[model samples]
Target: MRGSFRRYTRWFIAWASLVALGGWLLPPLVNVERYRRRLKSELEQELGRPVDFGAVSVRLLPRPGFSIQNAAIGEAPGFGDEPFARIERIECDVRWRSLWQSRLSFDRLRLEHASFNLVRRPEGGWNLASLIGREAPARGGTAAGSPPADAGGPLRLESEGARLDFKIGADKKPFAVINVAARLDLDFTRGNVNFRLAGEPIRTDMSLPTPGRVELEGEWTPGEKLSGPLAATLRTEGALLYDWIPLLTGRNPDLYGVLDLQADLRGSIYSFQFEGRGTLRQLHRSELPPPADAMPATLYARGQFDARERGRVVVESADASFRDSILHSSGNVEQVFSAPQMDLVVAVEHSRLEDFFQLARRFASGAGAAGLSGRLDGLVTVRGPWREPRLGGFFKAQQPRFIAGGTTFPMSDLDLRVNETGIRLAPVRVMVAPRVELVAEAVFRPPAPPTMRSKQISAPSPPSAGEPHAFGLRGLQYDLALSAKAVPVSDLVRFSRSLGIRAAREVDAQGIATASFGLTGKVWPITPPAWHGQAELRGTRLFLPGLTEPLHLPHARLEISENRIVVDPVTAVIGTSVFTGRLEHQGGRSVPWTFNAHTSQLSLEQSALWFDVLGHRPPLPLLARIPGIRSLLEQRTAASSLFAGLNASGRFSVATLTYPSVTLTNVVASAAVSGRTVQLGVESFRAGGGRGAGDIRVDLTAS
Candidate 1:
């Protein structure tokens, strides 16, 4: 038995050596180049294009394969003379048994350094349509009820360094892909194909960004018509997304970031569904200044598309997060007509407003958003079949606080709602101090037609035609009401200053002031705003800087309008004196004012309010250094348009008056001021039953 085994081993070794030698030496003896023209003709017929090559080599052993070097496939008509496809090298292997049967059945194909240009012609037909055959029934149809054609055996395909170019007419498309390495297993007998592809994204225009990697895997049926019930997954990562945005969206976007994305889908050409997730890290914008704080964000989505129905897309679910804050949404859009129809719903809960600001700070112009801290909850719904979308929603903030210019306002429980006609805020309350509260409510409507334009129409008319009143806020027209409860004067003054109301910041006051105000107007400052309001200030005990005793105003009624303010019958008590006045101010480029005041009884030493406006000093000069006094001095010195630029006139009557060492009865005075000059007349005065009158004038052009 040993001798027989040794003899068999020697025979096997000799046969293997002979086969190896034949595989290496047969190609040179056979003149394989002679068959190149024939092979090229066959390929041209199959590909529907002219084919050319540099060299062709045949291998007899090792499973019977051939190598073609430097092959090119010509383009279709009107697509220029450049080759549509080119390959540095290609190898194909066939089964030995197939060769024995005199059949040319390929088992495997490999391509290296291959490039293919896929183009869509100007008339909207693809260049490769001929190779794909007609989608309609063939001319010589098979008999009805005949068995299906037999699909060929499996073919393994491998490609390395492959590139695909997309073109419209003669111009390269914006986006392309290169450096593709792929592996495909096609089972024709089973009508199934499985493939893995990976590549780098490229831009046809060299100026565009080319900084991303993509990978994909899929399984599908490859029938004569290539109908699909396919499944696929894709992944991509990019370091600078803005560079590539123009290629995809044709817009120069301002965003910059590192982004990673992944998606999975299962469907067909007629209908499809997909889910995707993405992360954006180190995100910022080139146009915005660097943020003091920034955070990464994540987004998730799932959707379906139906090509049979106008290619509508329905987003079944979507979730996005900034830090711990999250927003969930769903929507559908269909372009079935010239105008699209859409419906969407968005809900946000447990979202941290501070974290959201961190993401929004780049777009906030480096203003007040960074100083906000709170949580938000909201629900929004939008529906549209007509031109204007209808919107309904509400957003509420809990324990929100914002700091600006070194002052903090704790705004609490703000609810903003949108209805059919306008946006509404029921009431938003803020704590101005330890025991002070400010509450406000508003309803903002859509913009109204210009009065002058609307006046030309005789009858009441609808809004201008062809101008759509779309959803969201267009131009803000609002009605507002505000009230304060037990607010301290000092705290209120500070709060008013923060709101750009500097006039109230310099008054020295004590105790609490209760106030109410209302306004109706458009919000844009460039347009004249309508104003209608009545504000009442009831001071428990208000003090002036140069006064020894505090004053009390029991009633002060003010009426406000777009161009005027009127204060009538104001009554105040200072020491034992009583005073009343009516003051009217007209708003214009130059303010014009009139005052008619009467005093039933007055004590000169107790009326500090009158003396305070003159930059007067109290008995103690140190009082001038107080906050209210200093602020008043600063404001007075800073004002370039004071009484000098004002047009004002006033008349006063006093029943009885007491000065430092004199007493007067039934005194009357009148004053006029215009453009840096003042004129005063003492109409009548009675002292110890004697009567007297005088007039005075002063020019104040310099000071």
Candidate 2:
């Protein structure tokens, strides 16, 4: 029995050896060429495109493996006329376990130098939908999909380790070009897949006509179904200021700056969070642009967005800082974003008004001094879509002061509101004097027909001297309602001086004086035309510096008509005397004004008082000669009053005050109407210059 068993074992060993030798020397019965053709056909059927393969080699090393050199796949149907992927070489591992998997399975698949194109349609769809359709079941239902009788087989899969070159955009009119040279590592596990790609500092060149170049570097790992974090950082250098300046002023701008940003992103489709910080430096105007001013040397901002739920995004926080040539501002903003609505709150500290004026100068519209400084607080709410944004906000400033056009004014407690129509400010308080306040309500809107042109009509017949009636008028018509209250008359004079109007200063005998009026007219550009209004003055004393002690007036009202200002029933006390006057604007470019003043019982002492108030004192020698002047001098008085109980009406034309070439048109003293001149006669005719008479005529059209 032992001998027989040995013989059988020996025969088995010999047979196995013979089989192995036959397998090795019998041309390796894999039919590699035939298999390659079969694989080519299968791939073509699966991809719906032609497949090309070269130099198929079969191997029997550690396991049965095959290599295909120079493999290429044609582009899918809607992809135009180019191959989809081209691989220099690919090696696949095939074994009994892989073959029994009921499908072509590979233990390992390696590829090199592969290229791909990604396209997006204008309607927001992609071309890769066909790739996902390939994995669906071939048969109908559970009964027909019954597991195969011999389903116990190893899972079949293939992974690639290749370098991919990718291009992005539509098939035609491609805009973005991205070149990626990376180590692509992918793994296909049972019911799950993991991929990791790392590239060496990818550079992107965008031709968007902006300022600079963009560069990026990062690694990405996409797990099954995009359930992982994706992050990247892109930087830009040499950004232009003009690219962003228009955002501030609603005008085209030219400027340059260096911009850099770093952003990080995390979360999935259900939620997302993005945080970033950026900076700009060396900002300046590109050229002679509208806001032809340079920006601050450096600007910086940091912000974050958080979306942990649907329908809402929260601006966790944001802060910005700027310091331009003449202005400086630093602030923070917090906002909430709902699909169709948005709300934000902003607060700024240490802001200067002068800087704002300088900015306005570029547009040829600025006020007061050029510099301003103060603190500001603001709140804004915005809703609706971007196409038609609705904006409303409130702004307030503390101790805001500015000097523009040569005047200095302090703004206290300024509150304003903005809407689509225009901006409105109520009770804007301006300090015109140490103890006086000017409160006003102002509205500014785009110039319309009524506001831009004056409406003028023929004037009605003039009323009698004592008749009280409204005047008729004609010409361009404008609606300008400005009411200034509780402002001292002296302050008004000072304010006028700041407006390039230099004239004799007016003194205030009363503690405070107030003038209130409304002016409406169609003023031609830089030219004054026919305007009508009513002005009321209330005060105890109206000081005309060139005359003497303040002229005491109980109250005064003026009726303004086209080319005329009528002061009716005017009563003023000047050293026990009363005077009245009517002034008129002689039509011309120089604003020539003529006045007819009548007075009764003027005293020398009163005249001296008026002259002193006019910012001048009587000459010492003259003071010594006149008895009245001497009496005032003995009392340390600086002025002498004129005493003459007389009714006189004099017409004088003062076209220009700087050089003051005065003209007396007519004078009637005590029933004597002098022609073309006024002659002043003292109580006695002994005074020098023979009554001081002169004839004069004013040429309003003189250059």
Candidate 3:
């Protein structure tokens, strides 16, 4: 019995060894080339395309699978000879049990270094339509239908180093995706698919003009009727947006910026709902003019879009933020692919003024910038037919202060309202000093289409054919009213200096003055509108160096008109002399201004007041140490050369004059100045019982 058992065991071991050896050697001995050729033909018939391969190899040990090297699939008939897809290497794994049942069921597929060229024929049918067992429907839609009978079972697909190109007719599109990697699972039985896809990193391809990367995860249930919801989350970060802008707009803004977006997508393939938050950082133009301090910003949006309507977007909520300022808005934009139309309301509440200046500085051109400080609250509504935009809004400043040159103006209540036609400002009251208050009100209207005045031009001529015509300069009109109550002249002098005007620094003015002015005009016209006002000074005392006694004005009144100002009478008391004068000065710039003065009595020692007001100083440096010259030299610098650009003349006469000890009667003089030249004619002079007349000329061209 033992011998028999040993014989059986030997036989069993020998059979097992033979079985293992056969399993290992069968794959090498089988005619895999013939099977490969047959399988290619089967696939061509099933896919309705031509398939070709370089070589094929079979494996039998771990699992039944095939590997093909250098394979390609030809395009559909009439779609050109260019292969639709090509692969350097392809691998497929099949179920072993299914092979015995005469069925080829792919369990796994992988491709390396593959490329696909998809085309849309002139007849509006895609090369891939037949592969998916669906006829091309109208537009981008698919017809309702069940899955084809040949639709395979569930499978997993993976690919690396893949490229995809698209073409319409015979022309290649501008966009192509390169260096793609993806893993996907398709369950045809359950009609569901899930995938993870990633594109090449930015700047990895030198041949690509616009380089970018996309990372996405998506899942969807494809109903039998080809209508169902899909959802995806994607992240795309790239430097491609700058290049893409020109493709649509026909002009490159040459912007240097980085764009990054994280978004969620939900809806059917035909229409989608999107929610996203993104940022544009370090945004500025590189080759053209750009703003300084271009602050980076954040953007958030939730909207719905339909693929069928290519140029419309509906934004349910949109928000943008730069620094401490935020704009919250919602609107519908139409024809985005062409001439866009927008209707939106942007609002901000409780925002800092410094943040607003950060945006305003971009538009400021010079030292005139109103560098303001405080808080702001505002709302702006913008509506557009696109070409003709209309804007309306209002903004309020909470305790705003403007700092410029060297002075500060604290405005307690400032409000601004704007509309399509004009702008209005609320009355503002400012405190300049302990006892001084300034009140101002203003309204401004922007230019409208040229309105023909019967005297200006014949009624607008009709545009000639093929000739472009534009509206003439219409005119900007403004109205401003200002008043100052109980203010000292010293403060006014300081304010003048802050406005780039020179003033006497050696004089100390006392007492209070009240002034009011109103101006209305079309600033664009060569001749501005009329400006008239009045001023009054009461109990004002002025003291200067070298003067033993102060000069006092008990009362003074001045009247203004469109073309000139008239001082009815100004009586000044100096020492034992009293002088009264009526002065007239021409105003406005359409013509040269002139001055005339007639005085009943005058004190020569106090003549420096006229020189001070005229921004002039006598050439006497050493005399400054004697108090009189010091006031003239140290009070203000030499008069500006602005006189060289002005034309002026003056006439003056004094019936009686007192100078220290001498008194002159019937003193009359006339002066004329033009472009660095001065002329003075003494009509007559009587002093010390002698009378004389003469003319003096001064050439100040070198001075």
Number of the top lDDT candidate = 1
- Tell me how far the alpha carbon of residue 2 in candidate 3 is from the true structure, in angstroms, after superposition: 26
The digit string of per-residue lDDT tens for model 1 on 1-703 reads 9999999999999999998998898877888776677666545533457888887889876678788899887997877777888999978786566565533556777889999888877655566544332222233563221211221456677889999888888888767788999888766446567889998887765576566778999997634434457788989886467766665555554676778899998886457898999987767666666565546679899999785677587989999887789989999978642356878898999988777666655543424322667888999887785345776799888888865556778887778887556667777777777767888878666566566332121112223434444543325566667777567767777676665553454345555566566555653221234555555656545544434445677767777765788888677777687678988998685776899888887776556434433434433243543434554455454343444456889998999888889888998999888986889898999999899888989876765
Residue 131, model 1, lDDT: 38
Residue-by-residue lDDT tens digits, candidate 3, 1-703: 9999999999999998887787688878888876876667645643457889888888765668888899898898766778998999978777665586554656667889999888877555567554443332334443343223343465677889998787888877655667889787766555666878887532222232553677888986655333466898988785455654554444454555667889899986556899999887656444434655557778899998764575677889999888987878888777775677778787888877767775544432332444677888888777775544555799888988766566787777678886665556777877665556677776655433355211221112222333221122233466566778778876765555455543344445666678887665653332344566788888877655334346788777887766777776776776555656665668555455566666677776666434433324443244332322343444333333344554777787888877889888998999888876789998998987899888999876765
Per-candidate Cα lDDT values, in order, are 0.69, 0.45, 0.66
Where does candidate 3 have its weakest 10-residue lDDT segment? 453-462
Residue lDDT tens for model 2, 1-703: 9999999999999998887776466446666787876677644543445779888877655456677888887765665556666777766665456465654544445555555554444433334333311222324522221222232222222323333333333334323222333322222212122223332222123222433444443433333333334454545555554543343223343344556665555553224565666666554334433343444433333334433333455555555555522222222222332333445545544555444445434333223335555665565555444333444566666677645455677877667675444345555566666866655554433334435343332212121334212111112223333345555555666655555542312222342344443333332121233455555667656443234344667667666656566665455666666667664444543443445656533444335444443345552343332222223333222221111111234352221111123322223422122222234421221122233343434221211
Ranking by TM-score: 1, 3, 2
> Clashes per prediction?
0, 44, 2
Q: Residue 624 CA error for candidate 2 (Å)?
A: 19
How does model 3 score by TM-score? 0.53
| Ten contiguous residues with the weakest lDDT in model 1 | 453-462
Q: List the residue pairs that clash in candidate 1.
A: none
Mark the regions of model 2 whose C-alpha exceeds 4 Å error after superposition. Answer: 1-118, 121-208, 223-228, 244-258, 267-272, 281-314, 323-341, 349-368, 404-408, 418-422, 435-438, 444-482, 485-493, 496-703
Query: TM-score of the candidate numbered 1?
Result: 0.57
